[model samples]
Target: MNLAKNRNEIDPKFKWDIEKIYADTETWNKEFQEIKTLAPKLKEYEGKLNNAETLYEFLQLEEKVSRKLYLLLIYAFLKSDEDTTQNQYQALKSKIQAFAAEFGSYVSFMNPELLSLPEGTMEKFLEEKEELKLYKFMIEDLLRNKPHVLSQKEEALLASAEDIFGAPQNIYNIFSNADLKFPQITNEEGEKVDFTESSYFKYIISKNRDVRKEAFEALFGTYESFKNTIATSLTASTKKFAFMAKTKKFNSSIEYALSPLNIPVSVYDNLIETINNNLNLLHRYVDVKKKLLGVDELHMYDLYVPVIDVPDMHIEFQEGVDMVKEGIKPLGEEYLNIFQEGIDNRWIDVYENKGKRNGAYSWGSYDTMPYVLLNYNFKYNDVSTLAHEMGHSLHSYYSRKEQPFVYSNYTLFCAEVASTVNECLLINDRISKETDKKKKLYYINEQLEQIRGTVFRQTMFAEFERETHKLIDAGTPLTSEELNDIYYNLNKKYYGDKMVIDDLIKVEWARIPHFYRDFYVYQYSTGYSAAMSFTSAILRDGEEAVERYKGFLKSGGSDYSINILKKAGVDMTTTKPVQDTMDRFKELLDMLEAEL
Candidate 1:
């Protein structure tokens, strides 16, 4: 049961060797010092935007320095997240953040000055610096801020003050990751199960009603103790956002937040409208789940129970890789080949271990390959997670290959699409291919959970964020009780009478860190639905869908998030993608009922 001590070692087969990025910590430190010294050289270009060649060299130097800085910063953060309590690791991580704040301050004027360049300065800069070729989109990204980039002094003021503004997220992170502890719950064997945030999901989703209830209650009840602190942190986070919006001259915080993605508020509105229309289908699926579980009462805890209690459905690590490859082959050979490189080249760190980062994400820098971190427990869920993370990695890989470093960073909107596309494809493919009925049911439930968590539940969070922000905007203070009421009510709307709506679920919003990002959670809803629509198109239309989806991946930030989605075939501005996703959920629920 003690994975950290017993099965703690990450299998060489699953571990990625980051040594290739820097070789060793000593080497990294040496490089870090070198990078620190390189900062002052950037000051050489402080006021040098009069000509194309000067701007070009300055931009190239800046980009090169930034690439090195990014690699260094990520390595430190990744290493620290793997174990935050380590003093040395914390020091390294803190140094990186502090350095980054300074680095950002140093380069803050690059944008304001670049925009200040004579009318044709941009065209000439691009023509002059052949090396700036990679940075065309990068420069244009700055140009996009032409409407917003304040003067050099104002921009520097904002940049230097970033650390001061990050107090909310920093406090939340410190409290959640380090300060809080959950009550121990006795397992079926009558042994006390010591719960960590890493293992909270396992307990709260246990098949035993008592385990789920106790875990859910104890975990959240612990959060209740710190609700005041959390609320204060949230207020700071909100005010930080509001201050930035005011300073940027945007009419509202939402507009300022979304302007970078080039997406209009209508897209966000369209998603909520679409989800609102289709929520009945989601409720219907919840109804089916309730009946299938045959529980007299369906609580929030019941939602995560194993629809099938069978545990051996856990596949081996190698088999999980095979499953992901097979699941994604629908995208074509070249696509699969690139993914295989990720698999073989240790682009992934699979399996849970002592001090490993909890959960999973796809991470890497534009200068490096996209790497995935997984705490795999071999459940069918892990298999799906593997596919999901690879989706992000390959998306990064492809965009890096197709676009320059400047255009390399894809918008969060597209980022989720790549991941969800693989997730949906894997779930659908696994369900379609399986012959064992109980296992088939497990497979089906797994897919349903995807919709439940991603498409439906996230929209619920999106709604929560919308209203919560409005609460702030309207000059109404959101106490824990008020926040909970809004969130709990949304849960009721989405799940209806089918599930036991618990009081504890109201505090869920406080626990979710994504709320700090402001208007970001809606992307999960939009992304899931968009993935479903695009996946359906690819499954039915084959080559055309694949090409469009691939083109969408390579688009990076070249287009608005909504426009990229629309061009890729799922028009988020319309309700069709949302409706299509809901219809698919209904079909799956109908099939699961027939099979059961």
Candidate 2:
């Protein structure tokens, strides 16, 4: 049997080029020291930003410091993620994080001071200094948050507490990724294999019911032992958001979280309301799964198993890249060229190794190539994840290439759109070309599951998050039992009476890392809805739609997420996108039902 390899055992070609950011730790340390001194220079411009030249000088100096600081932080984080157990890189990460807090405190006065400027003063400064015109949008955004800008001293106090605010997430990460352990389980061949967080999904989708049930029980049961500890960590994290929201004078934590990107609370409400209205469709899909699997009871462990049998197909990393290239050809030559460049330059770290971080993400700084991290297990889902993460990388690639440092990063509200669009395109390409009936049914099933997971499942998590935060706001304690009850009930509601709603599934909420980010999962649902809209348009209008979609990719945070998506042709404020996604889910369900 194949076992997980050590990081050194993996081929160098499969790993991302970390040295591209910094040659060595010595070089990183030297720059770290240099950046520490530059923050003082920023503090020097505190009271003197009223004048045009001084403000311009301050902005330039701040940008220089910020850019360098972000580069340092990125290097530290990448190194730490490469091996979570390595104390040297972990210490390096901690040092950078602490300094980042210090840096935030040092510059915290800038916003309050800038907001204090006389009306039209910033516009006059833009006219006075040609270089300051580049920062006009950023300045306008800052002024837009004037009501929330605290006094200089109060801002400094909050900024200095950044590390404290981040402790819950840090603790949870170390505990889950580096410390947690699972017992060995027997596979279908009666061979004992290690049941790990990275391999749990592999077993949970096994053809053998016993293997799936054992894997499910072992994974969540391990989490159950430490459920209370995780509950405390999650509660502290939620309360932090509540405190910060009330301190900033927002109506609630959700409003506070969404306000930064100019997203209205109505968007969040619309997602839950629309999904609730369409819960019958999900129930219908669940009923179909139960009937197709020919099971007496469909439990949580049975949800992910493929309904139809297909030959086992293992997708090699290069094979997956070639498939993605073909799948995304509709985006035209330029987009494919950039995508190919990333593959050639080793912008991805493929294959799982012991001690590496679990799951996947796309990360980099303004100065570095957008890099992807994955635990590639030779599954088709890994291939799809390749398309998903590269979607993020290319989005970052385009945004950083086109926008300045200030607006280079897009908001989380629109972050999932580009990635989901890639998945939709890839699955559509496969379904369009596959000639075999079983294979066609498989692709259709895959797309349906993607919608169920990204749209329906994530919306459930969104509702769970909203409900928990509301409890915290009402001064109610969120205990282990409370979190479990909330999560278990939502599963019952979303899955309907068709699913068994297993007892062990209650601990599932503790396993979600996104809970630390506060109200982030909802965007996955909304973004997937918007991506379906774009995918349909591209399929229909050809180059006209592709060009508009590319324009949306190039647009970073220069405008609000809603405005940017609107320019790209979808208006997310209404129920249209959600309705479109529901319609697609039903259409696929009909196709699968007929084929079966």
Best-performing candidate as measured by TM-score: 1
**Compared with the true structure, what per-residue lDDT tens digits does model 1 show for residues 1-596?**
22563233545776776767877678889989998999878887888867777777777778888998999987887777666556686787888889998898787667677787767678777787676666676677668788787877888788789888888898899999998888888876768878877787888767778887888888888888888789888877887787788788887777887798777877777777877887778778777777878878888888887776664765888898898888888899989998888888988877666666689998999878798888878777888888889988888887887876667787777778888889888878888998888877887777778788887888888778777776676567777777768878898888887777888887877789998889888888787888899889989999989999998888776656777778888788788988888888888888898897
Residue 84 in candidate 1 has what lDDT? 58
- Per-model TM-score on C-alpha atoms: 0.87, 0.85
lDDT of 2 by residue, 318-425 (tens): 899998888888988999999999888989988878888989999998899999999888877888999999999999999999999888898888899999889889
- How many angstroms is residue 397 displaced in model 2 relative to the true structure, after the best TM-score fit? 2.2
Candidate 1 wrong stretches, greater than 4 Å: 1-19, 22-39, 70-102, 116-136, 151-164, 170-199, 221-233, 350-359, 375-377
